[model samples]
Target: MAYQPPVRDHLFLLRDVLEIDRYSNLPAFADASMDVVEQIITEAAKFTGEVLAPLNSVGDKHGCTWNPDFTVTPPPGFKEAYKQLCEGGWTGLGSDPAYGGQGLPHVVNLSFSEMSSSANMAFSMYPGLAHGAYSAIHTGGTDEQKQTYLPKMVTGEWTGTMNLTEPQCGTDLGMLRTKAVPQADGSYRITGQKIWISAGEHDMSDNIVHLVLARIEGAPAGVKGISLFIVPKFFPNADGSVGARNEGVKCVGLEEKMGIHGNATCVMQYEDAVGYLIGEENSGLKLMFVMMNEARLGVGLQGVAQGEAAYQAARDFAKDRLQGRSLTGPKNPDGPADPIIVHPDVRRMLLDSRAVIEGGRAFLFWTALHGDLMHQHPDEAVRQKAGDYMGLLTPVLKGYLTDKGFKACVDGMQVHGGSGFTEHFPASQYLRDCRIALIYEGTNGIQALDLVGRKLASSGGRAVMSWFAEIDAFVEANSADEKLKPFIEGLAGAKAQQQDATMWLMQNGLANPDNAGAASTDYMHLFGLTGLAYMWALMAKVSLAKIAAGDTDPFYENKLVVGRYYLERVLPETAAHLAKLKTGSATMMALPAEAF
Candidate 1:
């Protein structure tokens, strides 16, 4: 099945749910009128559905072949599709205006990215990495670096890569051994090997700029000593054009991964490569965090996009495929069989996927709004609060959304029966592609740790309390909304469980550190589901109001139905997570060390 962009629902979320109409009046967003936003969404939907998605399955099946010359060629049409994406200016949608960017809102850029990634994730990573690199440079690079590099990157004339992982250390950056030596000409000589570098080597653009993390000689050990360097495939001269080729950057080989085969994940080798410091020496990790935070949100969106796309495919299939008779006895009297969608069990799967897809969509964009608020809010306190909330939610976005999104994809594929498992259908590829989301950009396990060990105690618990207070305010404001009663009640129950879990973790920390670690994953997931439920309820309230007012779109009514399904079924999973959290470290760590 070809990809279809959820442009209508995306516009509804922005215009109605989040109310970006207010942004239209803001000085920073004055250029983004509602009409333009709608136009962008419409065009984006066409590009993704028509151009990128067709290559998805072929990319996965053919993968990329590495030649003996060490050059990489992507699956057929990927190059042409990438050129189309770059030419369309989708690559630099949210970059800085001074650097030739359109200076669009991050939320708008995120919406476009969702459609692109949903259509073809592997194909999208090339520009995705470029966006991260542009963000890093804009946030931390010197003015000269910005002037020299940003425009080219923003124009999609060049692409970018973030090289942090080595064979020995993927998540644990403290174990990184890449080194940088101060060169006589105000540059540094970087030497290291990075593994699993996505978009590390591709011919889709003229140059590939690498933002690498390496330690300076005599620097302190661990993450603090790490410094960021801009190492390009070919260094540019003072005239703003490509110069001599850098000698050390090499693609030793590529990772043979299960999905996203069109993206070349290379094992990069850098031997005394000339590098320019991005920020002050030994401040690389801190600067890199900015990029990591952005990418984590992107990864979260990837999860939901795939989930929603898979759901669409499944729903279409279920509505057409004829199967066993309905339990209500011959609902389709004209034929020997009934549409599989007639079964309650099939509806259960379909509804479950829809619930997560819709609910997850709201939560994902809500989180992106926090990203917007983090930067755009003028008040210091407001920006700080938004940033803190963002920090607190980042782990949840990475861990919970991706986890649930992958499950939704699986459920969506299941709704297709035996056909879902076969190579002829794209469901298997969707499942494979979505699976990597759980492992990269800090594994769900690592995200869980960040939530329990770091974020829960952020600002001495002020962040958590403030966030809960906001939810409480929302619940209080809508308590009288008759249609939202069930959702509001579910939120309250989940909130209580979350509070209890938090308190237990705090109390148990002194006596048993392992307790927090053991309960962390479940606790994080529980928080995400509850949080999504609250957002979904908020969306449903608005949607229900529209329906009551005789809103015309079938989309609005679908939102209401899906919102109810989420409240009824998906929200109940929090109970299982809560049960696990209540168990603490006991069941998780009961076995002896020698048991294995």
Candidate 2:
């Protein structure tokens, strides 16, 4: 079966629900009307569906191979696909127009990004990391850095990487050993061994710009001592052209990963490599997070893309492949078996995948909206509130979405029966790719801790309060829509339960911090479900409004149905989390070390 881009649904979201036309009227997006956005998405879809998607299995089968010469080649056709991406200008969609970008909306760019990842996740990670590097530099880099680096990066003439993790430190940066020594000039000499550097050392582009995190000599310990540096693979000349190769940076080896093998996950070593400071000293971690947050959401979208692709594959396969008879009745009397989709259990799996994937897409879009509001909204109070909402929801979007998205992929694979687990199918590959989303860009555990500890009390809880207000306002506005009544009511109940749970943790965390730590994981997931439920209701409301307006698309009807499914099945998990949160941390800590 061939892949068809869901451009209709995407356009519906943009033109109808989001009414991006209003935003397009603004000066920044003046050239990005619905017609232009539609055209762009259509072209991007063609590139993804026709060019890159065919190479997915090939990339998996023939992972990148690293030669002893310290050079790595991506799987067959991967480089050409990358060239297609660059030539098409898909890499610079949301970049600053002052340089080489189209200066498009982030959500619009994110739509294209989702398509690229769905087509080929392993290949997508290369430019994806580059986008993060570009964002960090574009946001904090000096004027010289911007003028010299932005054009090349935005034009896809060069690529970039984020270098933070090391052999000794993964999450706990307080124990990091990477060193940065200040030179007589303004530059610094950095020496560190960074492991699992995605797009770290690849032959995809002319140069690799690494945003490295290292400590200055004699700086205070912990994350505070960290500083960000711009370390390029090949030094850039004053004219912004490539220059002599910088010594000290080398790709010693690549990790043997379960999936995304087309991209090199290299062990990078830097010995006194020349680097320029990105931001203020002793604030490297702070600067690194600007990139990390973007990357985290990108990872979350990766999970959604994998699940969507897997679901599409499985659904098509089930319909085409004849299997067991339906339980209620046999419709295909002349055939050997009925379509597997007829079975209740099979439907359950597909529905679960459908519900989670669609809901996750909407959730990601809403999060992206907040991101745009944070950056584009002029009012300081509005920006602050938007930032708070983003902070409160980022963990949920990153952690819970990926967690369920992994399972959704697994279920999608399971829909293929025995073939799902075999190398002959892509389901297993989807599972492999989806699994890492949970672990990388800070583990779900770390994201959960951040949500409970830092974001919950930030700005005296103003952020969370504003989030509750949005949900409350939505419920109040849609109260009369009977189709949405149950979802609105059920989601409201879940939100109330979450507020109580959060209050419990906040009050008790002050005395026994373990309360927050122990409940953090569950609490984060619960909050994510509630947030997603709220998004689903919003989607359902918009979908219903479209239907009432005589919108002929069946996709809108399906949106409402899936929103109901989320309400009835997925959203109810809040009760479970509430139960766990109410149980407190005594039982969790009851098991001592000797008990094991």
Query: Which residue pairs show collisions in model 2?
Result: 226-284, 227-284
CA RMSD, predictions in order:
1.4, 1.4
Candidate 2's C-alpha runs over 4 A off are: none
Q: Per-residue lDDT for 181-299 in model 2, tens only?
A: 99999999999899999988878798999999999999999988899999999999988888998897888899999888888999998999999999899988877888899998998
lDDT of 1 by residue, 287-384 (tens): 88878988898898889888888888888898889999999897788987999989999899878877877787788788787777778877788788
My TM-score estimates for the predictions, one after another, are: 0.98, 0.98
Q: Give candidate 2's error at residue 11 in angstroms.
A: 1.9
Poorest 10 consecutive residues of model 2 by lDDT? Answer: 20-29
Q: What is the lDDT of candidate 1?
A: 0.86
